[model samples]
Target: MEIAIIKYNAGNTQSVLFALQRLGYKAVVTDDKKILSNADKVIFPGVGNAGAAMQSLQLTGLDKLIPALTQPVLGVCVGMQLLCNYSEEANTNCLGIINTSVKKFVSATKKIPHMGWNTIYNFNSILLDGVKQHEFVYYVHSYYAALCNASIATTDYILPYSAMLQQDNFYGVQFHAEKSAKAGDKILLNFLQLT
Candidate 1:
């Protein structure tokens, strides 16, 4: 299977690549429009600021290319945040593939980043296949997509937020599925099996 990882300046490409390697798939990281559109599956992995990430995608025309993807596309962490309509992180507009707004966490404890492992509920999506409900997944994000119509799963931090989102062939996850260990790997495997 041909899998392409959208390479921008957002970071975490190697980690996602390692995860796919463990899964027995040799995925290539590239920003070429033809290579991306021709791939069987695409992964957009980001671990950076929303505004900067969007800037990178736009500079290379990936901002226009990503939302137009026909095959199944997965966005991780900030990559997922970029799929929304807008982001409060840097007052940036995003790809708008999911039609939801990403917002900053209103933490009462001053814990802005919301780091470490968190449990996800309402795992009815195929991406969570063979993974147990309420399983802890590694997360490291200060912002989150609000619970919306496209939300297929939920996770509670300061309040309930989207753990997983799906709209047509686009899917987004708030946590780092690649770094979530067994549960993460299982979810990645499930995504690979998507038809």
Candidate 2:
């Protein structure tokens, strides 16, 4: 299977590639428009400021390529944020593939970067196959996509936010599925099985 992982100025590409390798799938990291367009599946994995990430994508023309993808495209963490309409991070506009906005987490007692394992619930999608309700998944992010019509699942940190989002063939996850364990693996597999 030709699984393409978007290569850009972001962190955690190696981890995502390794995760896919562990699943016995060989995924390539590339920004080539053809490779991305022809891939069986595409994974947009990242960890960094949303604005910087957008800059990198635009620099490589990936910002335009990403939104036009017709295949199953999965965005992780900040990648998910970039799929939204806008991000508060540096006041940047996103790909607008999903009509939502990303906002920083505000809490009375919780700290920023809602890191560590968190539970996701109220999700029902082919991408979430084998994932139990309220299953724990790893997370390490500060900004979150507010709940919207595209939300497939919700997670609570200081408040409820979109844990998983889907719009057409584009799917996104607010959590780090690469770092997440068994549940995360299932999510990836389910995505690959999508037609």
Candidate 3:
């Protein structure tokens, strides 16, 4: 399979690549528009500021290219936030693929950057095929896509938020599937199996 991991200023592409390698799949990391467009599946993985990541995508015209992709596209962490119409982070406008907004976790008691393992449930799509209800997945983010019509999976930290989102051929995961171990692997494998 021709899988492509979208390379941007945001980090964590290596981890995603490594995970895919473990799954017996090889993926090319590139920001080149043509290379991304031709891939059978595209993984947009990020672990950085939303504004900066969007800036990098904009610089290479990937901001425009990404939303128009016809093939299946997967976004991880900040990559998922970028799929939204806007984000509270840096007051940035996002890819607008998913009909939702990314917001900061407002909890006076709970910690910021809701890190560590959390359970995800309410699987509403094929993306969570083998991932059982309340399965643990690694997460490290303060911002989250709100519970919207596109939310296929839900996770609770400060509140119930989108653990996974799907809109047409686009999919987004708030958790870091690469670091989530077996459950994460299943989610990644399921995404790859998508036609």
Candidate 4:
């Protein structure tokens, strides 16, 4: 199947490409609207500042093109945050595919950027199919999407937040599945097999 990785100014696309390669899938990284829309699956992965990333998406018109995708679309890291309604990262507006807002991690002792591996709990989605609850995933973000009706999985840093979100064909994960090891691979494979 053809998988298109939305190419923007965001980092981490290469790692995602590598991960897909490991899964025996060849994915193209492009900003072309037709290429993205026609793909069997689309993956939006990012690891950068929210405001600047949005600007990049706007430049390529990908900001508008992504939400219009009919097939299964997976958003990773900041890519996931962008799928929400808005983010406090830079007081920026987002795609609004999911009715949620991103907020900074409020911590009195722990650091702002909740870096390193963390366990994701309360899993309940097709993406989590074959993946156990409380599975450890790699995460590196300061801001997180709040738990809402669309939330499929939740994680805790200072409090419980939406770790994974599912709304129809749209799916998003706060952690970097490309870097999350075996469980991450299963999640991607599950998405790939979605009807």
Instruction: Score every model by TM-score.
Output: 0.98, 0.98, 0.98, 0.98
| Candidate 1, position 118, lDDT | 90
In terms of lDDT, model 3 sits at: 0.93
Candidate 2 regions exceeding 4 Å error are: none
Model 1: per-residue lDDT, tens digit, 24-129?
9999999989999999999999997999999998899999999889999999999899999999988999999998999999867768789999999987688887
Candidate with the larger lDDT of 1 and 2 = 1
Instruction: List lDDT for all candidates, in order.
Output: 0.92, 0.91, 0.93, 0.91
> Residue 111 lDDT in model 2?
88
lDDT of 4 by residue, 1-195 (tens): 889998888857899999998988899999889999999999998888889999999988888888889999999999999999999988989999999999999878998799999988887897898888998998999999999999999999999999999888999999999989999999988988888
Clashing pairs in 4: none
Tens digit per residue, CA lDDT, model 2, 9-37: 88579999888889889988988899999
Error of 2 at 71 (Å): 0.3
TM-score: model 3 vs. ground truth: 0.98
Best by lDDT: 3
Please provide, for model 3 over 1-195, each residue's C-alpha lDDT reduced to its tens digit, 9 standing for 90 to 100: 899999878958889999999999999999888989999999999888999988988898999999999999999999999999999999999999999999999988999989999999999998888778999999999899999999999999989999999999999999999999999999999999998
In model 3, the clashing pairs are: none
Candidate 2, lDDT over the whole model: 0.91
Error of 2 at 24 (Å): 0.8
